[model samples]
Target: MGLRSALFAAQYDAAMRHAEHEELSSRRAALLSGLRGIVYDVGAGTGANLPYLPPSCRVTAVEPDPNMRKRLLARVGPANAVRVVDASAEALPANDASVDAVVFTLVLCSVPDQAAALAEAKRVLKPDGKLLFLEHVRDAGAHAAFQDMLRPVWSFAAQGCQLNRNTVAAISAAGFTVDERENFTVGPAWLPVNPMVRGRATPGG
Candidate 1:
């Protein structure tokens, strides 16, 4: 990697590592239940979700950054029974109709192409498969406008994490419908940015 790329990786690793454990843990708790068969976590940074997931469920965590993958390996233990792979959401390596479920936790905001990524998730899912996720999305009311206004600057500083991605719409556009979901705040009013949306995708491959 070039100097800038190395620096960015280092910075991202540090930033994620510095994140509040409670913030991540709470969301993981809500999304990890009822998972069956193959579980694919998009942007499985540092494998924080590995510990909470049931041992019975087979897991394959997809992450692109080598630095993050290294951290993930260190965090995941033999008891968790996880398979961490070098991958990303925009394009998955699994064969068609192979995976039973795809998990997305705070992943879509950073994807360069949201539609392509969701399409990939849809393509790999079994006919009876489901899409599970917990994300921070554009909220209702003035908060939504605030997200829109701050998205450009936020995306730049955060390395492509847009603050205003219409996550619900994107999923629908990708051909999967939202079966259930919830939204809430993850940050204070000033920054007012932290939020979580959890649900399953429905009525599509």
Candidate 2:
């Protein structure tokens, strides 16, 4: 990665540290606690979820951005049982029904194709595997219009992160049934990425 990407990676932790401490950290711990088996942390930016994952599970932390991957690799220790892979959400280098769970933490917003990405997640998971996600979705109220208006500029500046995506619908459309979920806001009301959801889903009939 060049100067811009390197700069983004370097600033990422500091930029999000406040929110992580105030809200996201607890959410991550709750969602990942006791999770076991082979898990894939898709879009694993800087390995933020590594500390929360249970030690028994083997984790594949997939990140395509070299700058982000560099920071992510630094967090994976020998005892962490985590491996970093250079891959995008649309394609995973795993076999069919090969993993126990797939995770998406603040990831759906930036993927080029939501349906394809979720489909890939489903494809690599076992028939009984679970899907865990923590994402900011399209606002359901009037702010949705505001989200749409700001999306173009936001996506450009934030590395393709869309501010108004109905990600739960995309998850369902991709053939997963959400088993449990909690909807809440992470920051002040004025923040565009407010109104997030953390949940668990399994393959649907």
Candidate 3:
């Protein structure tokens, strides 16, 4: 909410809207196919996932930026099925394990505290519920090193986005047993890390 954050917010929102859920069109269908009741979507900018979810499901979409929420309100109507709240990944304004499912697509890399965010996700998720995720993480080997080296500048420009976060390790450390993860280079190395990572995590019974 300070000067730097305010400026960061402006650019970050533009980057997000420019990308505009480009990665979700295909993966979202599969991820959202089995959902039933209450759902939480972390970093739910523009409420793009609003339509992919089931009709019966009630989405408590958490987004921190007021400006982004203002824009999101235009795209996603204020229906009973959707309730948008101003919140951040570090702290969720929800009861523990209250939601049936949680979706985090392309949000964690940009989160300031990935571990804390994941821990919060774990805390708020129901025992039987699933944490569905889709992230672009650091590649393995030399490319991974490049991701780390470039992160300083990348983060500055992208508003906290780190190019080098390992999706597998971070989620595991957060207590979310990974069900699946894949690595792919949609483009070149050096800049703009591209490793499409998708997986699921569940709380221990």
Q: Which of the numbered candidates is closest to the native, going by highest lDDT?
A: 2
| lDDT string, candidate 3, 1-205, tens digits | 3566566655655655534455445566767777988898888866667768888787888888776677667667755457888999989988998888888987898888888988888888888888888788878788787778888988877657778888768888888777755554443444466777767778662
Tell me the spans in candidate 1 whose CA falls farther than 4 Å from its real position: 1-24, 77-80, 189-195, 203-205
Clashes of 1: 1
Instruction: For model 3, give the 10-residue run with minimal summed lDDT.
Output: 182-191
TM-scores of the candidates are 0.85, 0.96, 0.85
Reference-based lDDT, each prediction: 0.77, 0.91, 0.76
Candidate 1 similarity to native, TM-score: 0.85
lDDT of 1: 0.77
Q: Candidate 3 local accuracy as lDDT?
A: 0.76
- In every candidate, how many clashes are there? 1, 0, 0
TM-score of 2: 0.96
The CA lDDT at 197 in model 3 is: 71
Flag regions of model 3 displaced more than 4 Å: 1-23, 187-191
